[model samples]
Target chain A: MTDRAFAVVRAGALTSVQDRGRPGHAHLGVPRSGALDEPARDLANRLVGNPLGAAVLETTLSGCAVRPRCAVTVAVTGAPCRVTVDGRPAAWGAPVRVAAGAVLDVGSAADGVRSYLAFAGGVACEPVLGSRSTDLLSGLGPAPLTHGTVLPLGPVAGPPVYADAVPWQGPPRELVLRAGPGPRTDWFTARALRTLVTAVYRVSPAGNRIGLRTEGPPLERAVDGELPSEGMVLGAVQVPPDGRPVVFLADHPTTGGYPVIAVVKERDLAAAAQAAPGTPLRFVLTERR
Target chain B: MSTMRVLPAGDRALLVELGSGEEAEAFHAELLRRRARGTLPAVREIVPAARTVLLDGLDDPARFAKGLADWEIPALVSGAGSTVELPVRYDGPDLAAVAELWGVPAGEVGRIHARTPFRVAFCGFAPGFGYLTGLAERYAVPRRSTPRTAVPAGAVALAGAYTGVYPRSSPGGWQLIGSTDAVLWDHARVPAALLTPGTRVRFVPEEG
Candidate 1:
């Protein structure tokens, strides 16, 4: 818990501390920047008995190497990463106890994209804007973890409270987003909403924290018009002047001008969060009944 | 005139467009009032734009088009919001260029900025950032053709008829006129945002 100095001996593609992201700040221009793979992060945290939102290491596919300075229990979940402790093979998705100076190595995932390493306590870095998650677009949290970086773990008492290991996998192939209508629906022509559901849109390479730009038949508005810039939310599907549809993701702008064809359901956001580039996405219309 | 137009934004949020810049302002006021009284719905967040308000909660996004028909629209009050005085240095690189464009002395730009209190018309572009309207007609500056990759935190910038403060370090296209020391957001504090939708904000010259 308290007396811990965790250091990154080697970093792979990406490594950043992420807890649950800061929400309800979009009106202030902040995105709900957090773990893109929410389920994995949550599972990893639970394995180590960390608090519900304890900070975990969100390592991209390449993975990372870490050296802990104290006794700890850690687990890696999300994307399938090869994990090992001091040259001994370690099972992924399960907790492992480590003494001081033990080196934990995480390779890359074969099936999925992101892997989160959670500690028994938690990563205790400076919390910015009410969350430990890093917003690379906003510079809201600490920089990405690099080699030779030493991280401090939060305080934990007594024994670890581990959860029964239940393996889970993110949605594969086309992600189905449940949505509702938006402000500029009039901007679209007939069957616009139907097209969103019926048509299969390919995720564009231009996707990022801001939004997921997709390739589909240009959505025709009933009235081709301009919308005054207005407040936007995560999961908002905005159609730009080019006629292509772009679904606002975790780091969406506070406002936008394009007509919204539909919005993704809140519960389904995690599926979209882990979608890699070029993944196909489909839309479905549903009510809260 | 106040008009309610509700539309769905994706499957996540609800967008309500209220006609009249005046009505948008009033709706912001009413939102704060309801929030204070704790009668607001399970809305996670509500954002007010120039003439629209986005509501996000567990509400059915499909039913949003119908929800606007039932909301009690608030009355607009042009100058009724609380006034917050912000101190600025007015030393941004674009200050002189902006003044020259307006055919006035660079120092006068600060005067024009502080001439009247600005209303928080909306928050967009970035987090906790506010789009404060009510700039003097003469000082309305167009946005830079190409935005800077990184604008410093607390930077007070202007674009066209909108004046705004950058809450965090971000890329921006607005003309930076000055900087402020007030912390617009801090995660450690309760109610992280410094300027809510209805709060008034004013700019004052800060000497450092």
Candidate 2:
């Protein structure tokens, strides 16, 4: 009998199983922990003919190496990286067949910070709250992959979708995020608001799944006292006492006390995820729709 | 009557600001009522916090914002919801310290806690951990100067106008006063969180 599983050879940096994530449980203090690069994950799954909600591996920075116990179709997307099967070059952004016991290696990203690897059947893991995405903050779902981890793979669903060419967008040299006024915009000083849009910022190395912390001119506050802790939203550009802006991401806390000066449009956050540490960032203020 | 301020949280959600925690709880209850009646559209989450209720993952936030203007805010009594009794054994490491801060006997600490009816203000910090209110203003205590590396699960703890039970073992700073066997969170349960927003709770002291 053919075993349907893959053994992790090299789990580079941080790799974990991710899907669309559990969203409706914010009231239960659960973070919406999903693939940071949603389009990439979706594309990877689509190329492999897997359902959009099928669980896939999300690799950070350095990519991972896996050996399937059974033959499977695989596709790598998100960051442009080297994909190889048994030391032979494989296609990135397109489906490639991997024979059983062949080592499938996804190399370190050339320009982006994260990559998505989708197998034909998808990584089948026990779902917590209807999601396989790992919540780093809450320790929900499967833990980050380690060497020697054997992950089960679901049976192939359908034929892989073959495209003439798959367009891959390279990581931005200067990340441009569209910002709209936040609920607590009044908390910041007028000059600080101007600085937020005018001054150049860099992606802080300290950024994690929780938020995209920025290193730039601090936004001075107009309000003297702390705002009571209130529910926070994704893309909120929250400013702590340090005066720097921290764009809340998928794993952001359900509630926070700091004031939010602006919120980045959700569409632009996919690019923010690929931005490497110290990538130049610019906030473009836009009128609310 | 205080007016509710509907503010944009993001493109997808709105934060409705209320005057107090009680008002936030009341608004959350009203929203839940509207949802149950099918009057409110599908929303991903209705999260009530200190002074606001965040309506997240709305299909159309702009349209919903307009609808919120005409929605009537209902007056509700705090702790009016069904109550869940949690039996706790008061033998935490922070019991003596919490008792010292209140200038009461260690035995009296559990008595005061059990006497008060606590309403779930909001759930945060951890899954199924409810930040409950209803303790007197005098019981408002500061968090420990240094947080413990790891607080055990089922630890009934208190800090800054809120008393909560540790749903699962994790690092926490709240001063522990007791421990309970009642499950605060279970994924297999219909509603994973035992304590949700607007649920009233009672901490019953037990002899261990």
Cα lDDT of all candidates, in order?
Answer: 0.76, 0.90
Q: Report candidate 1's interface RMSD in Å.
A: 2.3
Residue-pair clashes per candidate = 25, 0
- Write one digit per residue (lDDT tens) for candidate 2, span A38-113: 9999999999999999999999899999999999999999998999999999999999999999999999999889
Which predicted model would earn the best lDDT?
A: 2
Each model's TM-score, in the order given? Answer: 0.86, 0.97
Error of 2 at B183 (Å): 2.0
Q: Give the C-alpha lDDT of model 2.
A: 0.90
Compose the digit string of candidate 2's lDDT tens values, residues B11-90: 78899998777778778888999999999988988888888999988999889888777777777875478999999998
Off by over 4 Å in 1: A157-165, A191-195, A215-226, A241-243, A286-289, B10-12, B59-74, B77-81, B89-92, B95-108, B136-139, B152-155, B167-169, B178-194, B206-208
Q: Model 1: per-residue lDDT, tens digit, A1-289?
A: 3368798988878788888888877777677778877788888887887777889998865789899999888888887768899988897888888778989998876655578898888999888777888787666787888889988898763355455656675545777777766556666776776687788887776776567778877777787556778877777788888777887766676777776766676677766656666778887767421
Q: Write the per-residue lDDT of candidate 1 for residues B1-208, one digit (tens) a residue.
A: 3366666665446677777666877776777777789866567777788888787764565554554455675576656757678778788878988888789999898888877678777777765677787776666788899999999999988887788888888888999888888787776677666776766888888765
What residue runs in model 2 are displaced by over 4 Å at the alpha carbon?
A: none
Per-candidate interface DockQ score: 0.62, 0.78
Write down the DockQ of candidate 1. Answer: 0.62
